[model samples]
Target: MDSYKLLINLPDTIVFLSPNLKVVDATDEYLKATMKTREELIGQDFLTTFPDNPSELLSHNMMIVRDSLMRVIATKDTDLLATLRYDIPKPESQGGGFEERYWEAVHKPVVDENGNLKYIIQRTSDVTQNVLAKRAAELEENKYRFMMNALPQLIYTTDNTGRATFFNQKWYDYTGTNPDILATNSWQSSIHPEDLPKVIEKVGHSLRNGTEFQMELRVRNGKGIYRWFLTRSIPMRDENNNILMWVGSSVDVHNTREMVFELEQSHEQMVELSEQVQQAYGKAEAERKVLHNLIMKAPVFFCVLRGPEHRYELMNERYQKLFPNRNLIGQSVAEALPEVAEQGFVKVLDEVYETGREFVAEKIKVTLDRYGNGKLEEMTLTFMYQTIYDENSKVTGIMVCGFDVGEQISS
Candidate 1:
């Protein structure tokens, strides 16, 4: 029986080496792939026959391959190389320099009947395409992760069973919570104690029904302060319509909630002030009607300030429109219009209150953050700060009436 002929007929590129790691025989496929002849490779050391290419970067060094083969010889066990880059020298007829190549090499020991290692069979498979494709895929995945982490919202993903699987870097930064803590659907730990129950119940229902999930709830931030967040999630399903994963995000809505609350409070204060004004018009209906019609329909801003801090007591429709959605009632002048403090308005109010005299300012240029976008705008206003007096001639409060004269000034 010709065992050598049978060994050479196997499919993969194969080479037989002596126990001393010297090439003894090689198949036709091995000679063709390596661009080497039987006469040139025979009796040559395995490492010397395929040496490391010094010019190529990150190429596999033969020393590592040699050590692996030695380990197999010592232990009489097979050694496998998962994947490695090795540049192969081209024949002189072709370019004589090395060509880039990747391979999966396997070395198996050939033991004799007496349990002595006599030869080693080396097999190799070309895996260059697979390795390069995997590297490109990794690069693309890294870019996607970077974009997700750059978002201001807290983004996360969960498996079909509602177990938290992945979270973006913003989640860790905003919550200061380790992902390990929420690995097993324990993400509720970051929610406010009062809101956690509702959040869990609603999320559980969504996972069970595979429906859209949304909630406005308070969550504790890294600073240990609770803030409102609008959380929304959607299911990712396979072609068969089976849920595979859930993608979710939480946006901070603290400022929006504050604005809504302030608007509601302002509405209630305006209704109460209207009732008070109506009750004060018990007698002299003609005079009261004239004052009421002028205050309501006067195209100018009108508001009354009371108390030592000059808290907003009453404001007309035009006055409320000037600072829309700002809960001006029950707020002092410095607290409500903080941007006006340095513009001499507060000083004028103080002088009027102390001397019980009226202070009139014309074409006063004031800087205000009109839209709350962190930008200040200059506005010209003609206003009067007049002191109110009770029947006993005691200063009670200040009445401010103003009109935006920016257009007039420009014209």
Candidate 2:
């Protein structure tokens, strides 16, 4: 077989350039790949035949290719160019436009026996598909990261072995920690010391059994205050049901927890007061004074509705603060808070009074003109309405107690 014919029929896209960078020859594969004939490329200046795409403003294709060829000649050694965007122009029959293309090229110097450069052999492979796929994957990853950072809950991911791999922006903001913590077991340092042991044990159990991990723990904030968080995590599994990773979120529940605790304590106090009032009917005036003092000193809101009309006979400072500068005492529930009445709170109070039973609601949403500004604001509360009784065991009034839990619910 003829050596030149063998080179022309080679499968690899190969081209030969003269010492002056003129295209001397190209394989049949190179001609087909460039959508050109041998007559159009042979003896043509290499740069002139393959110019940079005119539409690409910052195109450095010509400069990059020229530099590599020059380096091969100067060093009398092969030069490699990885992942270069060298678009090819379509033939007139193909509508005459540039087709975006990527390539990896190798320029090997054909040196004389005396070590002088004679010609350069260039080989290239199309890598457009690989480059485009990589870019698409990167864009999807960036979108996922943005969504994670935008969430109100602190989100994180970890390997199946329980090592921390990723954390959203809220986590860093709340804990005041960096990615360096992932290298060590110090990520748990942000957890309250009292809660850390339990967290570790629960996480270890999940890792061993591939079960969901969940717990309510206190986490220290950037300001050094510890707050309660309800955290839950589940394993991401593959087709074979093997755990690949763990995704988790921690929702702040500090406000709701505190409010509930205080509400329980106040409920106990109210129960004691009811017993005292019923037992010491002769000392009613003295017991009323003590009840007034207790209501005033209470941390949560408190109010008393007297008679079947549900008139606000007494209200604590906290209850009054709900509608600042507005008089609630001596007015019926419907009159003082028309919005609350519209939401059927009065009907709830009536049921408690008639049935002689306590009504409890948790994280109930209510719309109120809280500042008396006529602009309605939504709030969440955990509250109770307890029926008050007379010495005759007949229900005469109702006691209202609640705590605003809007912040916790919204979070």
Candidate 3:
């Protein structure tokens, strides 16, 4: 009896029989379910066990047990047999079907007759939980559809070939056409003819390559006005990376187009301001040249020396009188004058180049042959030579231009 392990204390109902189809034993489960007792079932015949067929479940479900056991023995199959079925009782008052509690029954062969099967066993488990879960999932899908329908933006979809699959109610409400009308094309019957080709081309590319789609096109609104819309789409792909469909949306962009036109108007104003700035620059250039000429002729012994190259770029009238007809431009220290080399000017050049030092000789003792060539240890001159730099901040050259305006001190 324990080998009838499943029958020991089943929560629902169970019955065990012998090879002669006699009720050799019965479970407390079966007795309680049928409103009978163990003694009433012990020696009863199988046909008389459930005398009323207990709602005819015997003849209806006995074939399921016999067929499943035969199918297993015949082919040695292991897949779940489709013989399992549901049974739920209902009165006419309950509308001819059970409210919700679904049941699943299982049957198996328990005994074999002289080299063939004799006794078969059965068990049923409640399936209300599974049925309820499926019902809830369906309700959730409908709820999602309702939310999508409430959106103000026009929603649409297409298959992998860019053929329309879905267009929401809002789209139909705006276009004044049935939702089914656009199955063959997305913007065909709806878009302005001038924008149709480009919209179709972009949508086709996105569908074929599973890419995101975006384009501007004109759509006819409910009022029959052709307005611009920015349509965008994203590809929906399956688990295997194959394109399943394309999901998309469109928004009215007429207001944004007007804003863009205003921005262009502002751009034209900026162009006119740029022309005025250019005219101001030309006037500034003319004044700058006049000032430069004045700086070259002022009564001062000053010149713009070209760094340590010792070349004179711009010299004043005083400096010009001091060195007459001397073209010192493009001349290095050694090539400028023999006197420039005779002095320690070359040493200063090499020192500044190696050490990046600023040399400013505000006062120095020197012999100038403008009066006469006489070497003096301290013929005082007010000279100033300092470093000058270009835009790159490099110490490119030294400015060595100043006047000698001093007399020697009496020793």
* The candidate that achieves the highest TM-score relative to the unseen native structure: 2
lDDT tens string, model 1, 74-181?
999999987888888888999698888888999999999999999999898888889889999999999978988987678898889888888899888888888786
Where does model 3 exceed 4 Å of error?
1-99, 102-134, 182-187, 269-411
* TM-score versus the correct structure, for each prediction: 0.60, 0.67, 0.40
> What TM-score does prediction 2 earn?
0.67
lDDT of 3 by residue, 320-404 (tens): 5554566656667566555656788667765755444434454666543332233323344554344567897566666444554
* Tens digit per residue, CA lDDT, model 2, 221-329: 9899999987889899999999999999887767657765775576566657677665666456655665567667677788889998899988888788778889878
Between candidates 1 and 3, the TM-score winner: 1
Worst window of 10 by summed lDDT in candidate 3: 369-378
Off by over 4 Å in 2: 270-411
Instruction: Write down the lDDT that model 3 would get.
Output: 0.60
Which runs in model 1 stand beyond 4 Å of their true positions?
Answer: 1-5, 28-45, 71-82, 90-102, 111-118, 125-130, 271-411
- Which number leads on lDDT? 2
